[model samples]
Target: MQTEPNSNPNGQDVLLPPDGDDVPRVQDLDLNLLKAFHAVYVEKNVGRAALRLGMTQPSVSHALSRLRLVFRDALFVRTPGGVEATPRAQRLAGSIDRVLRILQDMLDEGAQFCAATSRRVFRLHMSDFAESAFLPTLMRELDTRAPGVVIETHHIEDSQFNMAIESGRIDFALGHFPHASSHFHFSELLQERYVLLMARRVARRLELDEHFTLGLNAPDGLHFIAVTSHPQATELLERYGLTSRVRLAVPNFMVVPAILSRCDYALIVPHTVARAFSTPGDSAMFEIDDASTWPVNAYWHRRFDADPGHRWLRGLLMELFRIGAREPFDSWLGAPLDLAPDSAHNA
Candidate 1:
């Protein structure tokens, strides 16, 4: 027997059996012991791991001895300045980390969200247009409510969201995902229409503004730019027999206005986004349709429905886009709702 001084489960000092002589049974596994292993795996130093876990270095070593005997492998070995995990330990760490998180969430059930001091990092999927239309207000809300919380926005399309969310890649997505899987929860944010954007001078010089308003076929000389992220953007143009008129295509929406400023090319964009770029002096906006508007929704995995943080964030988005912030947002987008939707509706 090694006879190392270690604290037993009853909080009494006891001599532990020689490592590998007495293996820990399944019932012997304790949360603290697992926590010690995770800490050591992450910190790579027993002393640092002990400090992180608020335990003495001897306690961490004792825990490691029992774990190594049970696993029948030296899970970690002393390297130059710290310990290195064996292949088996590396494989075990991921499962243990996930279990710990799930257990923590279970313990945090019914807890109130403290947004003021939260350091939670939220990941989101948003398009360039959605970012332009939504992020400013969201950032302002974060700045005022939870300055420490971090936001990461990824421009992933809806098709890959199922895998991304399942792998814990994104916390939620904000956009038009009408046919998402049943395992996801969705709430309406707002409805938005797409619009045509072109330089005001060019519109007048080419007599394009007059022709477009009259619902007449545009001249053959007109050319367009397409944003590839919304395939519907191109399809809608194709519906109008404007596919052949597209001279340039790109994935991002941010550069469209700059391109329109310098060129005679026209691009289709969401009305909210168009509002940001289409002032009366710069760009002209044209209403596409009122009856064909698409709803931009907030989507998340249904499993997070009861998570306090998820609920808080979801509520914040719903409030910002749906209830509290709706009127001002609509006013900013261009006009009142009952009169006529004055933006493009396809994208």
Candidate 2:
């Protein structure tokens, strides 16, 4: 039996076998044709695409012709300004770009990473408390090791966190975020505990025995300053039954020190923030008994797991901050955390 040949949208006859198996064989296709199509789709002009691909105009045009034949469509239509992609071409652009990116990353894995010569910029998302605790040590290390590398930090909203990491807008997010999708890779950096900060006069006025046992119903004229918008802070307040005594609601941890210094209000803050704010004769810090310890982690997309530049940075962070043998509260001080041979995965 014989079958009629197929006709494309432009009325061009596409030759078919006797059995009507019209699909092109994958083994017979040249990968370079796809590269040419990608260049033209991005540049929107044949001449510019040729320039980008380091090929002559006729060569690029020939590749495009073969691509059109295989797809059975006019992928792009020429106009006075440039070329406009057809619906079919538009649909394929994203997948093509992703494939090319993966190929490039694979090639880069073989190259050696030289910190002195690399001018890479790393983007990170971190809360103000993490900034206060981590940035100083990180900066010192970068200045000595990777002098040319630049670090840019941004504040990420909860709604945009997953999208931002997937799209490569942010490289690493540092804090106590929940477990991410399998597409993301995360390692615990350290564990953090909460503490209470109060003014010097208040600390001196309250008896030590009574202060430790103070209940939510104790009318000792203590008004709590709460970070109601943050999940961790809100949960901590409610767990200790201090939500009813809240006299002021703030949005972040950075402003708590300034507010507490001027008023009699007390704040429950991360141990790092407590250390930063508790200067001599100003504010006093006290450990909250039986408070839960939260894990601080560093997150990156799985695409960058093997990248040389990213691996170097992640290693440095792990070496500097990973909690091993030191006490949780004392690790944030100038003392270095113990780095045992078997504890490499903590970072």
lDDT by residue for model 1 (95-177), tens: 88998999898787667689998999999998677788788888988999999999999966557878787666888888887
Q: Write the per-residue lDDT of candidate 2 for residues 1-347, one digit (tens) a residue.
A: 55345442223554433533477567646768878889999999988999999999889877876776666667777777777788978987887788888887878755568888789999999977888778877888889999999999999888899888998899999887784556889888777887666776665555332235333433366678887555666676787677888998888777877787788888787876676666555556565656778888889998888778888888888888887756544655553222111122222
Q: Give the C-alpha lDDT of model 1.
A: 0.74
Looking at candidate 2, the ten consecutive residues that score lowest on lDDT are: 337-346
Clash total of candidate 2: 0
lDDT of each: 0.74, 0.73
lDDT score, residue 98, model 1? Answer: 94
lDDT of 1 at 201: 61
Query: What is the alpha-carbon lDDT of model 2 when measured against the actual structure?
Result: 0.73
